[model samples]
Target: MTSTRLSVIDEIFLRTHRGYGVPIALQGVWRTTGTVSRDELVRIHDRLAVGKLGRRVGKPRIPGARLRWDLSPGSLPLECDTEAVENIVAWADAQADVPLDPQYGPGWRMTAARLAHGGTVVSLVCSHALADARGLIDAAAQSFSGSAVPEPISSPGSDAADALRMILTVLVRSIIATARLWVSARARAELRAFATSDSARTPPHRVRKMRSVVVDIDASQWDSAAEVAGGSANALFVSVVAATMAELGSPAVIVDIPFRTGSGDANSIGMATVNIRGDDSPAVVRAACKAAFAAPVGAPAGYPPEVVQLLPHRLAATLTSTPGRGEVLCSNIGEIPPALSTLGPHRSCGLATRAIHPAAIGPLPCATIRLSTYLSRMDGRYTLSLVSTDDALVESTEELTAAVHRALEKRNLAGTPW
Candidate 1:
């Protein structure tokens, strides 16, 4: 099928949809090193008609409404501008801030910057409700490749008896799980503290500006630093984030880290969100992440989204998701997928990444930090691209960015490239 109903999870995401109401966005930059091709552009445009791109469409106010990727009626212009590198990149970055129209149903937009120096900077503004960061990267690789992407396979068999047995088991266990979840000391403390914080829970009318920063670190050095810190590269990144929160003097913070399971069909993607809580210690953070993602959690692991959708919007927002869940939302898009890195004829050099939390009401995270890697020409160099609303957090963000570089240098491998 070219189209399908917005899944329960998608509907839930749309209810608090980013940019307009809820403020979640995905922005990415693909930098080319060699010649560009119009064929890649055409392939991407074609996928919008027949692939996962259709996942974006849905009717307003209805939960899990039927939606289709209505391929724009006419042909799209394949030609792009030949402009100065600075001008092109600037134009592309500016496009990331533009909001998508929820009603129109095309939840993704593409704007390109053709470098006069003989390359391209491609910018994608996508709705967070549509796909996670990994999903976005996968989509670009899949849909834009010169080769045709593999089609989705058929669903596996299911037994009614087995289904019934599982349902019964869950029914019996939910009582214990529910009780334990609320009665747990951690849960009580989290709610009590979060519910009491006025500045943190101010109503939705008080809109706070959304901001983002994209930072790149040397791939090997990143690994080396993590090894020195006694943790994984991801743990090192999270530790830096924790250090930033500490710099702000936040009292007891929460972080939501989502990782892909790679079990969904090409058209349907889902992920597991691990909320790491407690003090900002590298050991604590690494342990939490490890515990949350130790096993093979195929796509669609958690059932909370379904349950949350069943509740009224206000009640759901208050009880389960957002607001008090975390002070930051982070995703470390580990290594660049080969499908994406070599997706086309353009010899891709590096990739830039960023996420947006467009202006929204209520207290959102201080910032969303995404650490990504590129197919490097140089062994060990880093870069930073930050875009933020004019607010107090920007000041601390500057400090954190500087501190991150300093922390990397402490490992004595910042410029050594060894």
Candidate 2:
């Protein structure tokens, strides 16, 4: 038997869910050429539930112990909208508002709607605490290929015994971490000045909603635009995002790029940071990206993972700082699996993936980072997904879509919005 524990990042996401009631879920939308029947939707949903997304986070038996995964079947049923909608993108965005519980079980949901014109829009929303973007994609690909679900991995010992061992290990690591912090002058200084400004805080009175826009560009045109801009596809993506943020009145742009670390953990992603300007050419952005890739990946927080995991959710939230105003997350999902292009007897014409907060209501928790962009290549086209959380900046979907078009025009590229 093998033991599986929650990673530091996963633990942080869990804290956010329990403390703030925010269901930060990853959503993937697929536009198929033909309508998917209810029976087919159920079939796909059952397959996904048996995959990696089937597990839930099991709380530690005692305080200061680690959290484990409870291998069990999901209970959330497939949600189907009987009403046919013309705008599939809008329908997909509405599905993000559905509640998903990561701790209890069924940390994911699959919804489908038929397009009035002629196709089907299917969306799968998985709790971030359960899986990241890549993990979700992998699970979908495996399910589509009719792969057999692996047997659940069991714990080596009792929960009490595991707790005892974890507590002892954490004690030793915490001592070492405390000693390092005491000796490092920079660490001491940072701790003394660890506080956010009032302006940086998310106002509780601000009524904000998450609005998303999907744009699809021809593969040949995207490639040609990237070549003309003197950068690779990823660099072009970053440039467009930076420009869009700049158009929204950002002074400086700091982009976080998540790279795969090959770890089998649910959220096995290492982040790299790069700084760029709205007017910077794609070549400049490309250079910055190249430099960031070469640099070492840093820890996500100031404190050690062992220490943070030991603290209560309220205290742990303070340790995990929110992204600043001009910060943007540019996740390039790269090429998607061909299996995902076909879902339940229909071929997908376009696909988009993004992270959404289902419980986004009165006071946004991490509202400083107003915009996030995701890129995925499928079916000879590049689908760019944009999620804007700041009502003050984006105001409306049309404004956000217009800004994107303007940014693309500067790069001599054009796209069709969904």
The local distance difference test score of each candidate is: 0.49, 0.76
**How close is every model to the real structure, measured as TM-score?**
0.67, 0.89
Query: After TM-score superposition, what is the CA distance of residue 283 in candidate 2 from its true location, in Å?
Result: 2.0
Candidate 2 per-residue C-alpha lDDT over 121-234 given as tens digits, one digit per residue, 9 for 90 to 100: 888888888888988898788777677385376773466776677677767765765677868887665555444333443352232687789999888888889998899899
Candidate 2: misplaced stretches above 4 Å? 1-3, 148-151, 156-207, 294-303, 322-326, 360-366
Clashing pairs in 2: none
Score candidate 1 by TM-score against the native.
Answer: 0.67
- RMSD over all Cα atoms, model 1: 6.9
User: Clashes in model 1: which pairs?
Assistant: 18-23, 18-24, 19-23
Q: Give the distance in Å from residue 205's predicted Cα in candidate 2 to where it truly belongs.
A: 9.3
- In model 2, state the lDDT of residue 201: 38
